[model samples]
Target: MAVRVDLNLSLDGIAMPANQTAENPMGEDWGRLVAAYVGTKTMRERVLRDTTGEGTTGVDDRYAAAYFDGVGAEIMGAAMFGLHSFPDDPDWRGWWGEEPPFGYPVLVLTHQQRRTIDFANGTRFEFLSVSPQEALDQALRLAGGADVRIGGGVGTVRDFLTAGLVDRLHVAVSPIVLGQGTSLWDDLRSFDLGYAVTSELSEAGVNHVTFAR
Candidate 1:
């Protein structure tokens, strides 16, 4: 049987704003958004910080922690992995500190292969310059019966969901709006994607909703 799992968190209409910086007009208020969504949880660990600088007020921190708590392996996009084109600078680590939040093995989807990056914190980033199916296979192998998580930049998540790979999804809809930026629902064709509400909470300005597919 397929591994039962949960992928949690939300974005503005499923799209990453054009510029993710805090100063970017398109950037969402990270602190309020994070708190409103992922609230206090025992296993909560803050993995990705809003490069927008609302780290202390992170709304997604709780969810990221809870989600990571449930997964054994992670698959992320090249951009989200911090190797957009190429990391020519060895001094340039990802958006995270020396030890990234994803302490487990993280498989990054890329077109150009690169060497593995091993941090002292037991976190390792392996470049998977292969198709999504190949990457998923590798992730499952690394999972060793544990659940696999498809980390996102929207496109990656949509791809897996459309292929019926995602078992569940959690989204925290923040109240703020971005007049223009990348939209989460951009080219997704409609299909019978059904989700049952698992839970709901309100904080800051947004509503946090959990859906089981």
Candidate 2:
């Protein structure tokens, strides 16, 4: 099974915005960075659970549709799971509501251990404090031979990449530039050493880049 990473970032490689606060968790810059991806019909149908069929179609939607294909399990950092925003709030399930888009197991990498949360549509969240390899091992078991996705907020993806655990990485680079924020490529110099790079510009003005090893 392939270890994949699909993410959207600013032109400057910023995965998270600098002005993030409790008032604006995603921050103002997040919208611009992920506009193309969120505007797709696939995202609308899956993440938003919108059955209205009222979103963009074509290249962007194609990539958005491929995001969830064959992904049996997901591994994400605590921040991505909304733990950073509500550290003490035990009731905070995640950014996704009752029925999360991921219809599989989710391993939340966090220092603070919590009981496993099972949601509707077979989405299970298991908080764990383990190394990247260990986390992947658990995810693989939960994946049932399907691919393990490295869902991210920058730090987690970088950790897996540094550990040489990722096999396929797809990055959608938006046109906007967030001058300061969490960067995905900070310590990832020569990260594409063993991967073959491919790029394509979509109609939404986002660059669809993929690194496959």
Candidate 3:
């Protein structure tokens, strides 16, 4: 079982854009940054629940489909779960609506809430305030020997990356340049030194960069 991370980033290495508010939890350029990935046929059927034979069926679709390939459990930050936007709203069940695309256990790391939310489609949100290793421990057990994914909002993924716990990292770098935001490649010079790095340019115009151990 591998510890994996898949994120959409900008060509400038910006994983998240600034100017985030309650109205725009994912930041101003979030949609544009992930436009190519979300436009894939896999995302259309899974996240958007649209299976009308629409959406792009190119190299991006292959990566989109592989995102959920063998992920048994997920670990994410509260921001990725939408808690930063609807912090006071107890009814806010994340941005994934009634049924999230992840059909496994999800560990949400936050210091505020400690509620365990369960969905009918096998997705369970267990809020935990613990270190990355602790969260990974629990998620590994919950994962039942399958691969565990560190789903992110940049900071969370960076934590795991800094700790050297990520077995594989795949970044779908978009073609835009957002000058200000949370940069993903902060403070880690020559991060690719120890890993085998590879790149692929998709027909949708995004570059897929992967660092595998």
Candidate 4:
């Protein structure tokens, strides 16, 4: 089965989560920018509680690693891949420093033309100007049934979900709250997607909710 997972943070009472990312792990401030999307305090509470401390025993990095262990490829939007424009004068790689999070072949959806970026850890960034379907098809072909992760900045996940391409999801709802920003479901006209909770964990204020579609 094909699967695409999306994750985010938000305020309580809302349906989706917010988008909040600090400059870096240990940056200027403790926590500064707050990009709101959706979700509720209750939801955020659940997600944060599951990603830290003892709750991370069988969760977090281990769980995520296992999920992508033998995975074929990954599909990520260009915006999520980097913060600057492609084909620039200096050519910035990404915000993930040297080693990236994903080690598989990641197809980046972008309109700008650029050559593929190969990292030392075996993750190659292939830019694609085609549609979501095309990128997904390519991912599935390389996935070999393991699992194709739809790493996103929100819009990419919605595209796959609306097209009925996601089969399973592991959403990490954070504890922070952003009063206003882009929402995961803001443009969604319907919520017909059904998901059964497979597993749940609460630790360090992050709730990890795994769902099977």
TM-score for predicted model 1 compared with the true structure: 0.73
Model 4 misses residue 75 by how many Å? 0.7
Model 2 residue runs over 4 Å out of place are none
Candidate 4 structure quality by residue, lDDT tens digits, 96-207: 6666656778898988777888899878888889888888889888777767888875677878877777777666655665555455666555443477775454444456
Model 2 gets an lDDT of 0.92
lDDT of 1: 0.61
The digit string of per-residue lDDT tens for model 2 on 57-160 reads: 98899999999899999999999999999999998899989999898999999999798999879999999999999999999999999999999878899999
Model 3 residue 81 distance off true place after TM-score fit, in angstroms: 1.2
Report the candidate with higher lDDT, 1 versus 2: 2
Return the TM-score for candidate 2, rounded to 2 decimals. 0.97
User: What order do candidates take by TM-score, descending?
Assistant: 2, 3, 1, 4
How much lDDT does each candidate structure score?
A: 0.61, 0.92, 0.92, 0.61
If scored against the real structure, what TM-score would every candidate get?
Answer: 0.73, 0.97, 0.97, 0.71
Ranked by TM-score, the better of candidates 2 and 4 is 2
Mind giving the per-residue lDDT tens digits that candidate 3 earns over 1-213?
A: 899999999988999899888788778899999999889889999999997979999989999999999999999999899887778888778888889999899999999866788899999999989999999999999998999999997999999999999999999998899999999999979999979999999997899999999
Flag regions of model 4 displaced more than 4 Å.
12-62, 83-90, 187-193
Residue 175 of model 3 has an lDDT of 88
RMSD of each: 5.1, 1.0, 1.0, 7.0
**Model 1 misplaced regions, further than 4 Å:** 1-14, 20-64, 85-87, 189-192
Better of 1 and 3 by TM-score: 3
